[model samples]
Target: MEEFFNELFDYNFFCNKQLIEACSDLKEVPKESMRLFSHILNAHQIWNARINGLESEFGAWDEHPLKTWEEIHYENQRNTFEIITNTDDYETRIDYQNIEGRLFTNTIQDMLFHIINHSTHHRAQILADFRANGLEPVSLDYVFYKR
Candidate 1:
């Protein structure tokens, strides 16, 4: 499972870089798509920090909305790398609070999977947004990465 997650994370990071390269200009992307992408990246960082017992650099959504595509991409790559390098016991439980202040516990493996899945969901929306804006979206499927 760890190996699978690492591969997925690697593909995701590569695809994200491709998307950014495909975009002619960030200003052309829909605001909503940008916002959603930012949110997903921010959430990933916050959760990762919590799971690793590190202080969160940003507060909840209210405290910090991701401001730039560069910021999102940088953090996304950093976190993905961290996850791949992490070899701690996958079964170890991480306790963290959700945005609603609800306490929850999950294994490191689950958290990593969640991050990958979450990015996939939002990246789909971003592709749709690109098409709606009359822009061609990058091929970001796992198969595309494999090929």
Candidate 2:
């Protein structure tokens, strides 16, 4: 199970890095794309903090500068790797409060999967933004990354 998640995170990291690199080259990234990517990065950090039982430093909808995206992303992925390595039980229920302070619980594995799935969903939106802006969209399909 750990190996499975490790591979997934590796793929996640690759896909995100590819998109960031592409966005970095553009003169002006679309506002919608920036918002979506920021949300993606912030959400990943938030989930990692939840798993670690710490307060999140980032809000879900904060607008982070594009210049700082890669650094923030690396830190998030590193923290997630640490969490995965240290976690002994994938099924252990984690009790956490959302940004709205609503209490909830989920297994470690489920939350980890959510991070990747959520990112993929938003990255698709970002790709659409790229097309709308007359920019080439990055290929971020999991199969593309796999091959």
Candidate 3:
């Protein structure tokens, strides 16, 4: 599971960089796309922090604007790599509080999988925004990354 997540994180970072580079020259993109991408990263960070028993830096969704794209992507790469390298025991479980302050325990493996799946879902929306803005979207399918 750890190896699988490591590969997925690497693939995700590669694809994210490609998408950013592909749209580098675009004068404008839908603000919502940028917002959503940042939201994904922030959510991941918040969840990670919670699982690690650290205080979350981000408040409720209404409390902060999604971070800038460059910032989010940079931190995403950093955090994903940290997660891959620092986590060795897939069975290690952590207690976490949800948005509603409900507490539960989950394995590190499950949390890592959730982060990747969450990002994939939102990246599709970002791609749609690329097309809507007349920009060519990068191929971000997992199969494309695998091949």
Q: Largest TM-score belongs to which candidate? A: 2
Per-model CA lDDT versus the true structure: 0.72, 0.95, 0.72
Cα RMSD for predicted model 3 = 2.8
lDDT of 3 by residue, 1-147 (tens): 657877888877777676666556556656766666666767777766765678877653422233355566677568766776887787889988888989899888888788778878888988888888877777887788778
Question: Which regions of candidate 3 fall more than 4 Å away from where they truly are?
Answer: 59-68
**Model 2 lDDT tens row, 64-85:** 9999999999999999999989
Q: Give the lDDT ranking, best first.
A: 2, 3, 1
Supply candidate 1's per-residue lDDT for 111: 81
Error of 2 at 74 (Å): 0.4
TM-score order, best first, reads 2, 1, 3
Q: Which candidate do you rate higher for lDDT, 1 or 2? A: 2
List, residue by residue over 19-100, the lDDT tens digit for candidate 1. Answer: 6566535655576666666666677778778777777665544223334555666786677667657756777888988877
